[model samples]
Target: MDFFELVNRRESVRGYLDKPVEREKIEKIIEAGRVAPSACNAQPWKFVVVNDKAIVSQVARKLYDPLISGINKFALTSPVFIVVVAESRNLASKMGKLVKKKDYTNIDIGGACENICLAATELGLGTCIMGWFKEKGIKNILSIPSNKEVTLVISLGYYEDKEPRKKVRKDIKEIMSYNNY
Candidate 1:
């Protein structure tokens, strides 16, 4: 499918089949993230692919409610879970010797996450990007280093159910402007 069609078709998938995601496919998704542009080329993202049922259950248990409730359920049934981490301090260091903030790393990682999501859609797989979770618990569960910040969790699998219809959005004329609002 074309990029625009893929973007239109991509939706947050909350249900998954029992089949395992192929390792090759997972690698392709990861590669998409790896190649995403970053501020100053810091490339501060690291992805942890989790397929073990035990880990998935643990993650589901720690995920926050309502926003992530559907994702938690999907995690339990999905074949893969990828945790996106950002090396905040390391990225800042690369920015300059006198850097004082870490917010840019989040932007860099968010782009990477979006790339992974789009790549999954193109691969005929479903994905849901999750940010509502106990970061400390997930860090420990995934054996992430102290310096790495957990940015998002993505659930991946073969979709077993259809996605809900796309919600209506404001027209571009209402939301966009040629100059300052």
Candidate 2:
């Protein structure tokens, strides 16, 4: 698909079909993230692909809080979950962060997450990037070390048939500027 079309098609899908996503396609999606650029080429990111049904359910449980009860309920139905973990910055990136006073690792991980979502769209799969979950629960369930940060959880699967919604965004003129702001 054309890049623009793929970008337009990429939406936060909330509904999925009862079908399994192929492992090969999952690998391709992860490969897209693996190749994403990072600060000082640190590439400080780890992807934990969860496909086992039991574990998927356990992870899904962590998405809900008592008050809301079932936020991100779509997670329960998605066939796969890719947990994006942010690792510590490398020496160069750390020094750069100190000098620049910026967290480049997060910027890099955001790009990697976008790559995964775009790759999934290109491969005809639906994905939703979720951040409002119980981070501690997810880390414990995944056996992730305390040193790593749980940045995002992506639910992936084939989408249910539905009419596409019009894309809504700020006008280019409103969001962009020339040499002068």
* Per-residue lDDT over 1-181 for candidate 2, one digit per residue giving the tens place of the 0 to 100 score: 9999888889999878889899999999999999999989999999999999899889988875656866898788888999999888789989988899999877898999999999999998999999989999999999999777899999999987565579898999998999999
Model 1: clashing residue pairs?
Answer: none
Write model 1 residue lDDT over 87-165, tens digit each, in one string: 6545445656356444567878888988999999999999999887788899999889876788899889898556546
TM-score of 2: 0.95
Provide the lDDT at 47 for model 2: 96
lDDT of 1 at 168: 78
Model 2 ranges with Cα > 4 A deviation: none
Q: What's the lDDT for all of these models?
A: 0.81, 0.90
* TM-score of every candidate: 0.85, 0.95
